[model samples]
Target: MDKFDKKILDILQHDCTLAVSEVAAQVGLSTTPCWRRIQAMEKNGIIRGRVALADPEKLNVGLTVFVMIKTNQHNPQWLNDFGQIADEFPEIIEFYRMSGEVDYLLRVVVSDMKAYDSFYKKLIDKANFADISSSFAMEEMKYTTALPVNYL
Candidate 1:
């Protein structure tokens, strides 16, 4: 991708709802070329998908819990079953398999401690964990979905 392509991506990542003409205006391209570039990016999987970012506080789910999980089992079957268990909990928005001390990490958000306790019980019932630790996020100083595009 060239400079114009990168500039287009930089703009889109911030506000994808902008019209192709608006994007063209910002990125110094005409409507047709800009629209074509966006379409091409989508087809090539560079622009994966767009989503609405929600406000957790307004949604009545203000608490964020970071759950660190360690497990003895490394077999594919165990991991698959664990994945299914994770899928069952929508509150657990982000799940990642990790290296070093923790086998997996989950980011969970809920109404309060009581709700989190309920989620915890449900999780323990479904999977086996060598260890699990949680840290509450008291405040979110900065949170953003935008990835750094200058590196590209």
Candidate 2:
């Protein structure tokens, strides 16, 4: 990717609904070249997919908690089991295998503390781990689903 490609990515990251002509205008490219650049980015996996951002509050999801888990077993089977359990839980919006004291980190969303409690109990019941620590965000100062384009 060149400067024009990077610019295209930056604009799309902010709003994918922009018209081809609008993107072309911003990137100082004609319609055909701009469309080709976008298509190339998508073909090469740079632009993975487009999605609509939902309002968590409007959806009645008022609480967000990060759960850090340290597992007792590091076997492949146990890891697979843990991943399967996480996939089954709709409340677990994001799960990651980390490189630190904690073996995994999970981002869980719920309606309230009561809902979080229920989700926590279900999580512990599903898997046996060495330790599980959680930190709740009282308020989100700033949140963005966009990726940083400075590296480009």
Off by over 4 Å in 1: none
lDDT of 2 by residue, 1-152 (tens): 78999899999999999999999999999999999999999999989999998888999887999999998899999999999999999889999999989899999999999999999999899899999999998999998878877787
TM-scores vs. true structure, each candidate: 0.97, 0.94
The clash count for each model shown is 0, 0
Please provide, for model 1 over 28-132, each residue's C-alpha lDDT reduced to its tens digit, 9 standing for 90 to 100.
899999999999989999899998999999998899999999999999999999999999999999999999999999999999999999999999999999999
Residue runs of model 2 more than 4 Å from their true location after superposition: none
Candidate that scores best on lDDT:
1
Where's the lowest-lDDT run of ten residues in candidate 1? 143-152
